[model samples]
Target: MKKNALLDAAEALLSEQGTQALTLTAVADRAGVSKGGLLYHFPTKEALVKGLVARVIEEFDALVAEHEDGAPGSYSRAYVEATFEILTGEARAHRRWSAIMAAATDPELAAPLNEAMTRWHGRAPDEDPDPVTGVIVRLAAEGLWEVLSHTPELYGTARLDALKQRLLALTRG
Candidate 1:
């Protein structure tokens, strides 16, 4: 519980105030825990950042799992749905922005994200009949995710829904 609270505080700090404002002291205060409590879970800022990244991955994986069905291209479909959800949801959008910014600034921090992507894409080959198409769909979704993250209003809600449906369609084997 304390660990999650510390991580949540760190994420909230990063998302709301950017990396410059993310400090162990601030996180400890935000979480209403002592500095010693924070240190118990994360001895360093790097560890806190890594924990935040891991939590994001875990939440994203859970979202994908929720969308999974026993069918060809299930993973691809789930990936598309999960990507859309993360990009559009208000709280998730902020969390993702923080994670992206953190990863962009530090190569070491990107390792876990890269590993998760590899694991997710690796599953595509086995679950998706036309693996190439699956890869393409995933790429398209990722592209959309990137663009939407920056300019969510680029495509209005209706258009975004249409695009999401189209991506889901591409997952059909």
Candidate 2:
């Protein structure tokens, strides 16, 4: 529980202030725990980062599993569903996601991020679209996510609804 709390605090800080703003003391302070307690769980920032990466992967896997109903090639659909859920869910906005992404500029982080995406983009987890089309669609979706993350209010409800409908139709086709 303490560990999870620390991770949650770290995630919040990462989202709000990026990795450059992240520090062991900040995490400890944000989590409302002692430094010793935080250290007992993570021991180091790198370890905490690895933990965060693992949690993101695990969360992604669970989201896919929950929404895809065990079907193959369900990644796009799962992604759409999960994203909608994220946008609508009661949880805080995922600012940390952008921060963690920035942190991936480090060689160490780059490897894990690449590995995670490669594993997820393989046959079983994602759908088998035409390879070229899939690449295009995925890139486009990522761009859309960045836009949404950075300037969410720029998209009003109707626009978001329309984009969702169009993307869903395209993914289905």
Worst 10 residues of 2 by lDDT: 90-99
Model 1 agreement with the true structure over 32-116: per-residue lDDT tens digits: 9889989988999888888888877898899999999979999899999998888767554556666767676788998898888
Off by over 4 Å in 2: 70-73, 91-99, 124-133
Worst 10-residue lDDT window for candidate 1 reads 90-99
Per-residue accuracy of model 2 over 1-173 as CA lDDT, tens digit each: 46667888888787778777678999999999888899998998888887777776676668767877544335676766666666545442363364356457577865676676787566442354545455555556666666766666677778767776676666664
Candidate 1, residue 97: how far the Cα is off, in Å = 3.3
Candidate 2: clashing pairs of residues: 15-95, 15-96, 73-126, 73-127
Q: How far is candidate 1 from the true structure (C-alpha RMSD, Å)?
A: 2.6
TM-score of model 1 relative to the true fold?
0.81
Evaluated against the true structure, the overall lDDT of model 2 is: 0.67
